[model samples]
Target: MPKLTLDDLAKIREKTKRLTTIRVGGEYRAKVCVHMGTCGIAAGARTIMNALMKELEEREIHDVLLTNSGCAGLCSREPMATVEVAGQAPVKYVDLTEKKIKEIFEKHVLGGKIVQEYALGIGSEKTDY
Candidate 1:
């Protein structure tokens, strides 16, 4: 690689700062995991992921992170997803659609409220805190 100029160094520093900030402070809003295993793909995981990305972008939530993971052992209910907010329990949502993913982003992420009706296994009852 060529020697970095002052401007290049500054850009690198700025990107580093942004990445650190995102890692440390972003989890509070929501952590969304879209299962993208074979079963999930067959059930439309791509559309769900796209919807989530669009909603987060439209909302201007730059801190929010989108990730892909393997199956959560719920292949019978393919396209399963999970959303976990900082200081709150993670909730599993089954048979997800793009519409429902958007609803989850709004209600759970923006509104700070869980959408219980679609949750498959909520750990709210077991928590002592």
Candidate 2:
């Protein structure tokens, strides 16, 4: 292995931080999980994820954990995401577009209000918090 430069270390640090953010319970204000399964990608999940990332970067928002998971089990709703705000139930939004997701990030993720128009449902399957 080659010696890691300072720039390489910085990149590693950022990647680590992104990966570990979800584990630091109560530290983050919200969590956005984009479903990136094969169907999801074909339906444009990548675009949705990228738009969310751009929103976060432009807003300099650090308290929201952005991540991805496998199929949401509803391939018909391929490009889906779940947004969970602290102390609130997670809302699963389906049939997402980049434009709609950016609105969700702004209203639901940042403003703490569910965007009912785009949401499939509120609350998720039982999971240990």
Candidate 3:
């Protein structure tokens, strides 16, 4: 294989640094998974996700991974969000709105407290062998 030049190396370094900013690595402190299934979309999942992104940006939080997922077989509970912190059980929230999202960010994400009112249940983890 051809060796990478200094310019290429510099570009790689820059990309890595940028990834650490808005990107989540294996050492991420937490993850926010937004359900974007068809039902979720009809129920305003996009808006909820935008609200979440705004909150993360406004708070300048970088240790959290924000991702999207399919349905959780709870179509009635569309526009849901799941928060999974390192070393802690993931909590799924239902009927999410912008206001509720901010509340979740403040109470659950930042303060490490779970909001039972909006919370649905614990999210199951995926394991790869």
Candidate 4:
């Protein structure tokens, strides 16, 4: 493997810290999981995921853990995501577009408010933290 420099190591550390940081003492303030199943990919989940990463980086927001899961089981809502916030009900947004992802990031992720119009519904499970 190529030798890593101090700067490179620091950058890696920062990213790891961001991903592992807990939102509410021990839970993520918000978790953004993109469904990468075949159907989801066909629907543009990759675009949504890229948009989300850019948005978060530009905003210097790192508390949110950006992850990908196989499928959300909502094929009709192919490019969908489940935003789980600490102490609040998780909301699943459907039919995502680039514009919609930004709205969800600004309103739901940053502002701590769910975008009901784009959301299918709040999830039943709650976080233990």
The candidate maximizing lDDT is 2
Reference-based lDDT, residue 102, model 1? 86
Question: Least lDDT summed over 10 consecutive residues: which range in candidate 3?
Answer: 18-27
Provide the TM-score for each candidate, comma-separated.
Answer: 0.74, 0.78, 0.79, 0.75
Once fitted onto the true fold, the runs of candidate 4 whose alpha carbons sit more than 4 angstroms away are: 1-27, 124-129
Candidate 2's displacement at residue 118, Å, is: 0.6
* TM-score winner, 3 or 4: 3
Best by TM-score: 3
Report the C-alpha lDDT of model 3 over 50-111, residue by residue, as the tens digit.
Answer: 99889877877767789888887788988898998788999999999989988998888877
Model 2 Cα lDDT, one tens digit per residue, 88-121: 9999999999889989998999899999999999
Report the C-alpha lDDT of model 1 over 1-129, residue by residue, as the tens digit: 679988999999877765576666643466787889898999999999999889876765666667778767778886877887876787888888888888888898777788887789874222233
Q: Per-model C-alpha lDDT, please?
A: 0.78, 0.89, 0.85, 0.84
lDDT of 4 by residue, 1-129 (tens): 669988999999877777666543444568898889999999999999999999987887766878878877778987998887767877888999999999998898888988989999888333344
Model 2's TM-score against the true structure: 0.78
- Pairwise lDDT winner, candidates 1 and 4: 4
Q: Candidate 2 clashing pairs?
A: none
* Model 3 RMSD vs true structure: 5.8
Ranking by lDDT: 2, 3, 4, 1
lDDT, model 4, position 6? 89
After superposition, which runs of candidate 2 have C-alpha atoms over 4 Å from their true positions?
1-26, 126-129
Off by over 4 Å in 3: 1-26, 125-129
Superposing all C-alpha atoms, what RMSD in Å does each candidate have to the true structure?
A: 5.8, 6.1, 5.8, 6.1
